[model samples]
Target: MITRLAGPAMHRPKLILVLVGIAFLICGAIGSMATGRLTNGGFVAADSESARVAEILERDYGMSGMQLVFTVESDGGAQAPASAARGREIAERLRGDERIDKIVSPWTDPAMGSMLTSGDGKIGLIIATVLGGENDAPAHAAELADELTGARDGVTVHAGGQAMVWSETGTQTQKDLALAEAIALPLTFLLLMWFLRSAVAAAIPFITGVAAIAGTSAVLYLLTFAVDLSVFALNITTAIGLALAIDYSLLIIGRYREEIANGRDKRRALELAMQRGGRAVAFSGLTVGIALVGMSFFPMDFLRSLAYAGLAVVLMSIVLTLTLVPALLTLLGDRINRKPLREAKPVEQSLLYRIARVVQRRPAVCALPVLLLLVLLGSPIVGVKLGLPDERVLPTSLESRQVGDLLRDRFSGNGLGTVQIIVAAPARDGAVPDLRDYQAALSEVADVRSVTGPAGIFSGGELRAPAGPGTTAADSAYVAVATGLDPYSEAGQRQLDALHAVPEPGATVLFGGFAQQTADSAANIAQGFPYAVVWIAVVTFLLLFLLTGSVVLPLKALVLNVLSLSATFGALVWIFQDGHLGGLGTAATGYTIATIPVLLFCVAFGLSMDYEVFLLARFTEEWEQSDKTRQANDDAVALGIARSGRIVTAAALLMAVIFLGISASGVTMNRMLGLGLALAVLMDATLVRMILVPAFMRLLGTANWWAPARSRGFLEKVALRE
Candidate 1:
């Protein structure tokens, strides 16, 4: 297949270049508009109890939970005439806004004034419900946050809550993406020039990287019209696209240069390069693409959006690597080797060849220590705790983070920690009695400070006040239960579980709050995790089996990759959750973001398999060309490592540099992703590929190439050949 495609590319290189240039221009224009179409929130599970309660609150009760929180502070204290007047002014401004569905403030509702004000009486709270769903609420909150946050009439007001946090997070992520590109691209170019040893050769990979990013963006732009995509997908696609494009381009160009140096003419050399390098790239891309498809097993749009973006970028990189890169190499010919930076090392004398020889001599001695070290590095993963992101994920310099700190430290029970309960009870004779009992039961749950409903305030299983203004309707009841625990803490999760366990009076009841939402999101991801893992493992095993024509080799590759990924997860827990790496400029949030591990596994696993396929292709090719003896297997392992090690090392270093640039982000989740990927790639290249693979293959001997007789026929039919 590559042979047929290489003919036209060699025959009309100029035409191919012109057509690719035109396509890039079109894609660049379309891709520039993609960010505007993306959304800021996909963290909540759409079918969870929290989401159902939110929907019912909006549709049946004509109200939604508090979407915005403002901390109003004055030096003169809460009851001072001037402070009271300023608080009323802020509430009045919000009350007139069309975007606000409901407002609760000490100034507006004196019935709950004591609960709304701080214990010291110098700070007060104002909470409002925005008039939209997840996507629209953040936009509305941003506008209100901009206009209302600042000093007014001598009272300082700061805006926060989930909606405002999402808004600020989206804006900050865009800035960080730009910063990451600025840092990664130029550094990558210099490294490429050093590795390729020529300006013209380096430019080819750089150009392909740009094309991959732009083309994926154009595809994502089109996808947004059909499905809702998260803004977070943009950062991931950009980094992965650039890294894979350059990696594939390096493989093809390196092989093309080797062929030319062996005295082959331009046309024949291009054919062999396309046959060998091009085939490996095809398998590598397919492996990575299949691994990313595992994300589709998850129900959240966030993971699915990432899957779409990842698949698009992988396809774009493969197409450009197979077509445009080969055409450019065809045009350059002998000139591709001009302006040498350094001399190339012979494969027999390479460092990887020497290591492979040492390992082959004492395979068990070499393998056991490395295995122990990896297991030790991975020990921290057993303690990993998962939760949804909140204001703590952002930098402390941000307004939302500051407000969250203040609320947690200085305030009492308020909207920030309130648990909203919606009960579906029709207007019936004995409804009030059942509701009273239910509220009393809820109030008795551990961590409950108070519960407010039509039965008024309930504490310690007793009523303390009359019914509030908007707690009841003819057919439904809205209850607010306040607690003092941090919503993302383990205790808070237990609190959520306990609340759900309490018996309800109504036939249907839904819980909606920050704690409940976080719990539900984590639960949803956990439920989907097993299915995703099965899909990734089964499909990856089949693909590797087809590639190698050996059942044992594929299984060995899967085991090594999983071990490498476990170490990566442990590092994430150590750095981000346990707060050991202060230099990364992110505070330890005490729990990993629920999506980070899953996202990292899918992406990094595919990438690990990418390098695995590259090395295995060379190994299989060398083994098939020699005798099938044990000594021949040893020679094949050494030769394959020596031959493919340079490409793998160069690609891993380049990819690591890009990911480390992304690690500089202020958001903890982005930082975790960036640093974890960097660790995974570097570790896979050096430890797994260089050390463990040679040791394992030497230990296994010729069994590495063994397969069943019946499966051999099927493997022959579908096997990838270089």
Candidate 2:
């Protein structure tokens, strides 16, 4: 099928090339509109307990996760007439905007008390709610923040909150994507030229890359009308599309050059290269697409958008590889080799061949140490903890991050880190629960600095008031538990766990707050993790088996991929989570965001399998051409590595450079993702695919091709490799 398709594409290369250019121009225009439509928030699962509570608050109380806070700092106390008057003036001005639902300031509401005032009396908070909650926050946040950021009547103002943070994060992400590409494209081009040894050949991947990115962006734009797509998806789309484009182009162009050098006619070389390379591209794309599809099983829009973006990008790359790349290759013909830095090495005599021979001679010695090293590196994951994305995900230079730091450090006993306990009245009694007893239980819990409830404010087992204005009860009573520990820390989670265990019988209890939200997000991810693993494992094994016609190789591929991914995860924990990379001048977020590891596992695993498919496709082809003997198996292993290793290594190096450039992002999570992904690609290419794959193949010998006799017909029927 691929050979037939290539014949016409090669014959009418100019027409096909013209069509491709036209498609790019059209899709590029549509794709440019995707960014404005993409959202900045998707980190929360809509069905989780935290989301449920948030929804209730929004629907019933007209409250939302989105806020726009003005921190007005002045020399005089915030309660002084001058400071109070200034704050009210700003609030009153904002109140006239119909898009603003409510504005609260300590100047007008004495009940807010210290919750809105700094201990030193220099800082005061003016909190306002958006009309449409988080759904509409981003649109309003930028304009409101601009209106509120400047000084007013001698009071220095800083604007922040969830809305402000979201807007800034979106802006920073776009900047980072541009900066990453600026750093990556030139370096990638140079590396491609060095590998291909021809400038004309090196530029092909960039064309395919641009086409894939533009096509995928247009698809994402279409998806926006059906589902919310995250702004971060653009980064995923660009990086993965570029990497896959380079990878597929390298495979096809290198194979075409080899066939031409072997004295085949240009037409024959095009046919053979597309037949084999197209199959490999197809199977590799299926593996990646299936892995991305697994992320869609999780309810979080963050992961789901990646699923959509990644799948679209992979498919776009495959189409370009099969269509545009071959069309270009056919047009170039011998001119593709117009420039060469040096004489090309023979396949059996290259550096990769020499390395494979070394590994083949001592399979166990070569494989065991790498396996052990990976296991040792993965040990830190046993202690790994996850937290949801917060203001801390932003660069410290951002005003929102500064405000978050101020709140955490300056307000030790304030409500910023408080856990909200909502206790609904008994359905039979229609009366609020014993608020005093509930408050007592909460106060007695370890790490609970204080508890404010409808009955009173309780601390150290003492009630300071019978009825505190801060605690209001309608159909449900509210209890606020304040703790000194960081809400995302181990101690804080423990305190939250302890709060859940406190006695509050005959009442429907719901826990909500920053800490609880983080915990719930982590739990939601964990809940979907088993299904994601099963989907990837089952899908990849079936796809690899169909491609290779071997159960053993698919299993081996999974193990090698796991080993490589484990090493990447371990590095992530060490450098990003444990803060070890700070000395190396890399950014570190003290905890990994909950979605990152899952994101890494799915993406990195698929990428690992991509190289696995590339290498194994050659291994199976060589084996099928040889006699069914142990010596033939050995020869196949060595020959396959000799043929595919350079391309795999070159692709890995180029991709690693792209990932590292993206790691320069100001957001720590993006940096973590970039660094982890780069590490995974390089390690898989060098340690796993190059070293361990050959060793294990040598050890398995003829058994490497073993499959159930009954499954042979099914495998041959669906076989993706020529």
> Model 1 compared with the native: what TM-score?
0.96
Please state the error at residue 194 of candidate 2 in Å. 1.7
What 10-residue stretch in candidate 2 is worst by lDDT?
A: 581-590
RMSD, candidate 1, Å: 2.3
> How far is 115's C-alpha from truth in model 1 (Å)?
3.4
Q: Which is the leading candidate under lDDT?
A: 1
Measured on C-alpha atoms, candidate 2 has an lDDT of 0.82
Pairs with steric clashes in candidate 2:
none
lDDT computed for candidate 1: 0.85
